[model samples]
Target: MEKRVHRPTAWHVTHWSSDPFSLGAYSALLPGGTPQHRTALGQVLHERLVIAGEACNAGAPAMTHGAWNDGLRAAEAALSAGARKVIVIGAGCAGLAAAQRLRAEGIDCTVLEARGRTGGRTHTVELGGVKADEGAAWLQHFAENPLAAVALQHGLACIETDFSCPLAAASDGDLPDVDAAWIALTKRLDRRLTLAEAINRYMVTLEPAHARATQFAIDANLVLEACLPVERLSVSALDEEGVGYGDRMLPGGYSELVDLLAKRLDIRLNTPVMRIDWSSTGVKVNDEVCDFCICTVPVGVLKALHFTPALPETQQQALAHLGMGKLEKVILQFDGRWWPYSRSGYLRWYDQPASWGEWLDLTDAVGKPTIAGLIAADAIERQFSGRTDEQIAMAATEALQAWAAAIRPTP
Candidate 1:
């Protein structure tokens, strides 16, 4: 904390307070579950009410692009159901995407957003005259992600980032190597085993040193990538559904993509939907009657909404099974760059048990002295959640200083 260079000149947190739909960042998949659970959560009720968002996407749940794709699917479903006028709720990426697709198809639809802006969780803000994405920053699997196409179409520049971090290289001592065992186990894992169980079983067979290193790598990977601890994650689900290796960042921030999607769309801002009444005849959103309605609100917000006659018991149970994961970032802008700039965009520290160890170096991309410290995992997020902004910033400052000191201790 006494390090002068590590101290941040300015900082900002995108808590998404005004938008209830983005309660956290996005929804998290539970163990032994498929995206089918998410799709089922988006089931159309009575042929009048349709649910759409990243939560409803079976392919890429909890992603901005997934939300956009889900919007298109919902719009198509509404049109196929012979809907004349459709009402889309929550003007985030999902709502805006649905409205844009509906307009393209010559379908009459209106987008009602609770906030006075678009992009939902994808908010871009200026810090020290440089733009940074507060939420939904990366385009994972850019070649396959639909958002990449939109970015390319709009002439937005994207910088590919490699998030791979080797713990062996970072660790001072010679750690045990579990690469062979890990590869062998991953090649043929028991579908019945949870990620934690699988990892524990593998660790028990390894040497004590190797086991410790293996455990650290597994735990860090799960907490850093999935935003969940190993126990809550499914090994089979992860093995079957691999997170693509490639990721890219929008140098101009994600709001640019949102801006592109918002053009020529009927988006009504600051109009929050209080209640919904749906039946075979039609659906009414806040007393506004429409042939069909698409609810793109976040799962947290959706659960709180009042439904006329209430949702089915099965649907209610499905909703209860789904839960949100907490993930926050502490972005610090320094007077000068202290961290080494390299092709590897991420830095991981295993010193603290869930502090802001993983950081994204934005110096190269933003052309500024900024580093965003990612605080993932339930325990870590909860710890930071209870602290004030000043406290969190101080903790981050200490962590960064420690990281720098460890990497290159002063004489």
Candidate 2:
């Protein structure tokens, strides 16, 4: 990997992993959605074949808590319908949660997981003896989030991170209070216009001279938080949804919740369900028959599975219209803390539009010299997908060094 140190700091990219199918990391409402339409999307089929997952949750889709809540809802429905034996496909957050609830209610159920391990998209990996999350890192709405309640109940280490740190520069004089400007623009954003149009108009109105640095900071914040460019996002949807504030991290890892939910459950690992035969009698998952079934697989994986009598036209249409946001993370380890440490658990760079600019510092939380950088936007994600880990790491290091240099004062 290409290494660049502004002041002789030591660090190395220890390990990294990419999830090609993590398209649903952040779900967006894209410009179209009514109450009736969202309700229809979450409907269960024939009372015996139920669908539950992050994508199936219309209220809060593309979130870990959403998946868990959906699983609980599905389990309740199945039990109320007199379902004694149920088959839950995919032992991810949703599947595990449903099974847990079912077991609590004295209902018989089995969880079939495609992968050998559980947690699904919430994967935690160890780098240089320190555990860090590879997927679904933070609790966006910690105070109000149910997952946070569970973590707190279990005595897991949780640290609150300030995501709204003021914009920084090499000299204090050059730094503008961009946070105030951004909040003002968001407050007055026209709901009718797309996010891209609204952002452009706001920039022209506020920064008539079009300062490149200010624009970069604005775009970087949007991409880092939303995981997609403003052009593809909807102003009304984003405003109404309002990406929850006050994020918190699990120092131990996000998989702790998974382990808690999967306790003593009948889980079959490395078992891929190829087909689901939901006939008039009951649901059959690749020869394993049950009174009811809760399919909580990812949207992409769900689309690939074969059905005996085919999915309903409405479901097919919903899947076709719904799209997943693309995102990837690059984790780096260093011999000791190199970057400036602060309670604000992140570092932002204005080098490139889609560079690995948003980095999460784990030094304070995990007490380790590790940081994970996020790469968002479709174009940059695809570009990184084609290159080697070394190339990506080198680019990230260069961008980080440039940012450090830009913010450091002259000796």
Candidate of highest TM-score: 1
For model 1, how does the per-residue alpha-carbon lDDT over 1-411 read when each residue is reduced to its tens digit? 454545788887545433466666666666765656776877777778888898777687767788889988888888788888999998888888889888988889898988888888788888898888888888877788888988988789898877654322233444344355445556655666776777667667777665556555554555555666667665533532324567788988988888888998888898988899885498888979999999999877888899886888756766765656556777789899876555576776654355664777888889889888777665465546677777787788777776666666667
Please, what's the RMSD in Å of model 1? Answer: 3.0
lDDT of 2 by residue, 301-340 (tens): 6767898788888877666655455667777777776666
Please list the C-alpha lDDT of all candidates, in the order they appear: 0.74, 0.70
Cand. 2 TM to true fold: 0.86
Alpha-carbon deviation at 306 in model 1, angstroms:
1.7
Per-model TM-score versus the true fold: 0.89, 0.86
Question: What global local distance difference test value does model 2 have?
Answer: 0.70
Off by over 4 Å in 1: 1-5, 16-19, 165-190, 193-206, 234-243, 381-386
- Report the Cα lDDT for residue 291, model 1: 93
